[model samples]
Structures are given as structure tokens and as C-alpha cells.
Target: MKELYFRAMDAIHNACLFVAGAFLVIIVLIIPYGVFTRYVLNSAASWPEPLAILLMIVISFLSAVVCYREYLHIGVGVLPAFLHKPAKSFLGWILEMLMVATNLFMFIWGIKLCQTTWHQAIPEFPIITVGLAYLPIPIGGGLTVLFVIERFLTQKFFSEPEPETISQLTTE
Candidate 1:
């Protein structure tokens, strides 16, 4: 059961990471295109600026989830490095629990934020709702919770999981 859950969460986490990476690439290409069209062609481009901002939101939140999962999120490693294994693991649990709390806040308030703006449309793209732009907040938060839960179930919250083999690293 735990293995199944791990696989499921890993799949979701990978999908979000891929989507965020795609958003980054899209913004890189599209923003330059927008600038060229507006300045060189003297065209009034309506979509690029707003689209870039939207993609940025997705990238910001989704990358955070990935970073936390991979043990790459910023922290004061100096202190933890000196501690015994039990103490280090205890501290890690505390920090992760705090993160879970923050995620919960985001999940709750983000939905409210989305609801508040759901009916409002963006000036750049009339069809896109303000809520749609805000979707990443809660989705990211919720996905983070899923990942944290998985970490706990897999014993990763208390201790570092085994280092991955080459294929394991690339497949995800």
C-alpha cells in the first residue's frame, strides 16, 4: 500500500515538474517573441505579458514543491550538520511539520482567493478568469501536502532515504 502511494505521488510530482518546466520554456520563447513583434513589427500584442506572468506563478509554486521533495529547499544546514542523527531527524520533522502548516494555510486561503476573483476576467485575455490565474496557489499547496504525506509514509521525513540509482533518478 505504501509503495503504491509513493508511486502515485511521485507520478503527480513529476507531472507538475514537467508542466512547470514547460511553462518556463514557453515564457522564455514567447516573451522575446512578444517584444520583437511589438517593437520591430510595431504590432500591439495583447497576450504575451499576461501569459508570462501566469506561467511565472505556475513555475514559482510548482518548483517549490519539487525543491522541498528533493531536499534542495534552502535551510541552515550548518547547525543540523553538527547534530546527532536523532537530533537532526527531529529537527527535520519540526521543519517539515511547519511546512505542512504553511501549506494548509495556502490551501485554505488560496481557494478563497480564487473564489473572490473567479468571476473577474483579465484585460489581456478576456476568456481567462482571475481565479484561473490564481489556480496555482491552492493546487501547488495541495500537491505539496500530498508529497509531505508521502514522505512521512515512506520514512523519509525522519531519515534520508537511500540515494537513487541512475535509472531511478532519470525515470522520474
Candidate 2:
């Protein structure tokens, strides 16, 4: 059952990586193109600016979920470093609970925030509603909740794997 959940969440992790990478590529290409058009062509294109902003928001939020899962998110470790194994484990649990609370806050309010802006259409792009751009908040928050649950069950952060574990995993 745990393996099944890990497999599922691994798929989500990969999908997030792909989406964030794609958005980054698009941003890199479009921003330069936008600059080129503005300066060389003497035509300021509005599409690229807003489009980049939208992609950035998606990338940022989605990438945040990935970061949290990987334990890439910034945290305080100095105190934990000094603690014994039991104390460290307790601190880890406390921090994990706090993260779940924060994720839940984002998840609940994010839906309301998204809905409130649903009617407002982006002036630059009529086809896409403003609400659509805000979707990453809830998405990321929900994913975080799942990851926290996984951590609880596994008794691990699933963050950085130790070198020995990595070697063992590869061998197995």
C-alpha cells in the first residue's frame, strides 16, 4: 500500500517537474522574444509580458510542491542538528504537522480566492479567466498535504536520500 502511494505520488512529482520545466523554457524563450520585439522591431508586444507572468505563477506554485516533497524548501535545522535522535524525530513530527496546517490553510482559502476572481477575465487574454491562473495555489497545497501524509506513514521526510541509501536503492 505504501509502495502504491509512493508510485502514485512519484507520477505527480514527475508531472510537476515536466510542467515546471516547460514553463521555464517558455518563459526563457518568450521573454527574450519579447525583448527583441520591443527593442529591435520597435513593436511592444503585450502578450508575452502577461503570458510570462501567468506561466511564472504556475511554475512557482507547482515547483513549490516539488520543493517541499524533496525537502528543498528552506527550514531551520540548527536546533535539530544538536538534538538526539528521539528529540530530532519529535521535532520533525512537530514541523511536519505545522506544514500540514499551513498547506490546509492554503488549500481551503485558495479555492475561495480562485472563485472570487473567476469572473474577472485577463484583459490581455480573453480566452483565459483570471481564476485559471490562480489554480496552482490549491493544487500545490493539496499535493503538499499528500506528501505530508506520506511522510507520516513512512517515518521519513522523503527529502534528501543518504549516500548509502542511494547506493543500496540502486543495487536493489
Winner by TM-score: 2
Worst 10 residues of 2 by lDDT: 163-172
Q: List the residue pairs that clash in candidate 2.
A: none
- Report the Cα lDDT for candidate 1: 0.82
Give the per-residue lDDT of model 1 (tens digit) for 1-172: 8888888977887887788878989999999999999999999588998899999999999988877777666767677778888987888788778879999999999999999999999988899999999999999899888888876765565433235511132344
Output the worst ten-in-a-row residue range by lDDT, candidate 1.
161-170
How many pairs of residues collide in each model?
Answer: 0, 0
Q: Tell me how candidate 2 scores on lDDT.
A: 0.83
- Give TM per candidate: 0.87, 0.88
